[model samples]
Target chain A: MVAIAIARQTVREALRRRVFWIFLIVAVFLIGLGPVLGFLTPKESQTIMRSLGLAVILLAGLFITIVTCIYLIPVEIERRTIYTVLSKPVQRFEFVLGKFLGGFAIVFLSIAAMGAVFLALVYFQGTTRGPDAGVLVWLTSGKFPKEMVLGVVLTFFQMMLLAALTIFFSTFATPVLNFFMSFGIFIVGNLSSVTESLTTSKNGLTSAIGKIIHYMLPNFGNFNVQNAIIHPTTEISNQGVFIRNNIIYALIYSAVLLILAVIIFDRREV
Target chain B: MATVIKKYPFETVRRRMSLLPAVLAGLGLAAFMQGQIDPDAKQFHPKDNFGKTANGGLNNEFLLLPLLGFREAAAGLLWVRCDEFFHSGDYDAILPLVRLITWLDPHAENVYITGAWHLAYNFTDANERSDRRYIAPSQSLLEEGVENNFDIPDIKFELGWQRYDKIKDFKGAEEAFKLAVATKVNKNSDDFPYGAPLKTLHILAHTYEKQGRIPEALEEWKLAIARSEEMLARSPKDYSAKSLHEAEVRNYAENIQRFNNRYSTTGHDSVNPSPYPEVLEPPPGSADKTPRSWDVAFKPELRIVRPKVFKVGGQFNSQDGARIDVRITDWNYQDRKITGTLNDFSVDPAQTILIDSISVRKNHFEREMDMSKDPKMYSFSQDFYRVVLSYNPRTTAPHLLDRFGWSGEGMTDAEKSHVFMDTDPDRTGTAYIEGQGAVPPVWDGKTVPFTNHSQPLRLIKVTYKISREQIMNQKPISENDIVSVQ
Candidate 1:
């Protein structure tokens, strides 16, 4: 019941935010314009849909996650809202959980609305052309529409995990430092494959630097579900092996970073 | 419940957030597990389903309209944009542009169908000895269109016509024609002409003829003739009218003539008599003009003629198939003017007698033969050399009638002689007058009995007859043995 209350209040606050509406408008407009663009392209409608869908999800999700965790959280603290909140009957753990949930709700609502339009475009495109003979093969190829929706839901959770990491960083550091550190970590994490390749190179010094960057950054590439859309025909195994492996890696990395944030925040002279 | 709460440590806050990842991971795990035993694969062959759905979706009306409009614009742009490349005959430029246009508008089925068909049929494939490679792709494109638009007969007709006309796959063409005809009839449409049914009928007739079904072929030809005529009548007097009518009449007439000519067996009632001189009297001023020899017959026109050393290809029986230049400078040779058929046919392995002239005995003969077989070169019988051999057979002896297979089985020997005497040379070796004299024009050296005109020798009837065994067993010889029969 307590978890439910925290979830509901967080969801409500996110709905009231102005940034949420702005993101919603942009995403919706793009999704609606998909058919128009498809008409112009004539040949590459399906490919265009894929590129745009990925772009929308990544851009909107990142905007909501970074701004809420980095700017909003620090602003509330600077305004002494954290003191008032802490003075209340709510536990510090609940506040952190609540803040994470609120930021996630805003991102989720925006993604869901945008995703709905994007999915409708895909569905409309499919149906208007009549039932595809490939539908059966496509269903067998990847997670079906139901399973894909489940994947998307899981992806939102993945973004929430990243949000938690951002908040942890913002707790102790200045806004400037927080922004730099969060963005730097995000960039490096996304390019983990590049870092891994660098580490395996012949140069010892470069390999050392790559390794240090790898350890310091959270490997956010693990959270990417976009690859699934690109090659839906891929035979992803059922051992829960890859998904479990990525989650474990993300959790471990996020935990270590948050621990460091906690240590720094605890020692700060506020 | 309203009492003051303790501040939770950061570690505790981090632990609560951790459960979110764990739960999401569980969901993802369940989904992945479900995918392993995919029910879709057990029930269906995936590729077939994909093709069927792809075709079905492509053909849907709504899907086709926007695609057609888009493709038209796109193809137009591409045609202009790649103008230079196409002008240089670089097919690489045009092929991809057309491919892209088709991909965008698959249901604009005419693009691929018409494009490939025009490429093959109008240009390359229809050229004199049709190209198969060009035809195959053209047919394949039309076949794809047929499969996609199963109800449309245009693609079917195009495929069938190309199969018949270009590939010469008449049976396959007949099948496609049947399909198109059946489609048109069942659909009950008048606009699209059902050429297949008519084509099928024509092919059936052609097949019957090939199988030696003469009666059936005749009947079928008559039927086709009637049908084509009927179509010509009903059709508007368009540009094809005059030629169509002319072709119909000409074909019918020719077919009837051929039918009559094949069955005709009328025998020749009278043999053609020789046009050579009945008697040859000696010249008055000669040394041989003594009292006893005064009665000796001689041809007076033989004096001014020159003997030619002509080059002749080897006989049909020799392996070397050699050619020889023979010098014929013999002025007093008694047979200088061979009046009767001088069967100086070659028997020598290396030599062939080239007959240069025969104007009462001296006229030119131009001939060629592939000496792959031993050539026939036989000397005339004694009776042919007789002074009175051209007269009655009982009284003096007819020179031509005294030959083998003559009189009793006259037709057989006459036919053999006719076969040998024809001037149509074999393709392998050639014979020509190649000495220091003007090559004379061909002559049989005979005139009609009481007329001033010379007896005509039909040159077109001349041919070389070498049996397969003779051609195979022929031996080669040297060039020095070629002889000229003056």
Candidate 2:
């Protein structure tokens, strides 16, 4: 019950930050402008719109999750708020869990907002056109491309995993250091998919690097279904099973990271 | 690092180590998920979307997008750049870009079609002989496109057209068109959804007719009509579809009627009674062989009338679809016998022209080619040249094949006498005029006919040792071996 109250307090704090709203407004605006960008492409307007819209949501979600979560624990500690929180009946592990859940709330709410906008843009791609074509008609003329929901769902879970990683780092590391570490790890983690191809490379050195990246880092690339989304005819064996497995993987990995953060923060001096 | 670790207690380290099992299990699931998401072998190419398909030529910059997971969008952008290359006439640049674009977007059907078309038609030899070397590669692209787009018939139609138009392999064309007709038609398909397979059926019928299979052609036409009816049923208000269906039925009925009457022995036709072979098959086997084997008597002759043009006049059996190979080259030129793998793009600019297009079927063949229009292509710097009028049955079209089948078993050349320039002014033949001291142009006493032999199928050879004066019309042309009627 105490953990839930603290978690709600963290959510309330994140919502008031101007930076959170800035990130979302910009992301929504870019996704809304996807139709105009579609015309600039030589052909394959539908493909380009879906790719750009999904890409916008993902990039925006990444910044929102990282920035929101990284500042959560550090600012509380700097302002002596952690002392007040620790004075409560809340256990240190519970406090860390509550902070992580609050960060989770921020990630969920922001990604859900971006995802809804992205889905809306894709659904109304070309339902109406010509002189009478208005914004509402453009959204209605085309058939709703529902396959994009798969990409959006996967992206959300992937960002949640990223949020957990940032909160874990903020438990011990400074916010500036936490930001760089999270971003760098994300970059290397995205390369987790490349290890398979790199292992078959003729160069011995490339093979070694590929193995290291594959085994050591978190697998962020597993969540990317953009290629299959753009060309749905490409087989994936079982979409339901594949997506369920990915969500499970993200949860398990995020749990492991949070537990390690809780253990490390347990003995630290306030 | 050792001091800091020593300062830290083993108790904290033990606590962190306690979570090792959970960490290990998490990483294990992560690896499993990676494998599940990206299986080892898929029908579609994963490496291409990432621009990591080929070995050396692949651009590293192209790899950047896929690394960030925007692979499909990156492919689309590269294809746009490739379009710009097409408009600028940067043909050579387009080849490499096509490789990159298709590797990136294997599902881009239009890219595959345009790339193959450019390969088959763009690069030409100086004399306008389409570089036949690229034909195989072009067909290969279309084949790959079909494999990638299993449900789409657009690429299959292109493959059929390539076989029919360029390669002239009607059997291959028929197979491709059949596959195109059999594609699972989806009206809502993004690329080439099936409104109808009428176009494919139409082309299939034409291919059958070209191969002398009239019965099969008639069936294909009927199938096309049926397909149109299916489309009309789906959209009753589609007047254009209904009219098109009507036109096809009328065209098939009228054309089959007139065609049967013209090809029939009795000058009459009945689509109901029977179709082709029974009514249209010209007598085959021995009956077809007897007349075509030894009847197309070839009387060959050639003369240089203009700087670039030559007058090739020859008589054949008049059985139609007969073409003679006429070659004008240096007197010492020998045919290059390419033995091993042919280096395809090596069809370089020829110093002299060898256009194997002398029409010899209808009574007599006579056409003046205007080589003067393109001097850069047909440069005649050689002093003495030979005009070879040869007809090999192996290379002739189907109409000629109806007559001469067995390595030119029926085609024959008239008797060619060993004619040469009498360089010795002392001799006095009727070919020599008293005022024109030396009748033979300007050559040594021993100038022989070009690579012609007494062996059969060598066709006719006209060896003339003419100088610049003869070419300039300053003197009468020394026409030798002009075998006239006995």
Global lDDT of each candidate: 0.42, 0.64
List the candidate 1 regions with Cα displacement exceeding 4 Å: A1-10, A40-43, A127-129, A132-158, A225-228, A231-240, A251-270, B1-486
Q: Which candidate should be chosen as best, given lDDT against the real structure? A: 2
Chain B structural similarity (TM-score) per candidate: 0.33, 0.59
Q: Tens digits of per-residue lDDT for model 2 on B449-482?
A: 2111111221233444555454444554445533
Worst 10 residues of 2 chain A by lDDT: A123-132
Candidate 2 Cα RMSD (Å): 13.2
State iRMS for model 1.
14.0
lDDT at A145, model 1: 47
Q: What lDDT tens digits, residue by residue, belong to model 1 across residues A126-224? A: 622345636565456442344345345545655665676787877776778877777666656655445555666799999888766554445554444
Error (Å) of candidate 2 at residue A218 is 3.1
**Alpha carbon deviation, residue B100, candidate 1 (Å):** 19
lDDT of 2: 0.64
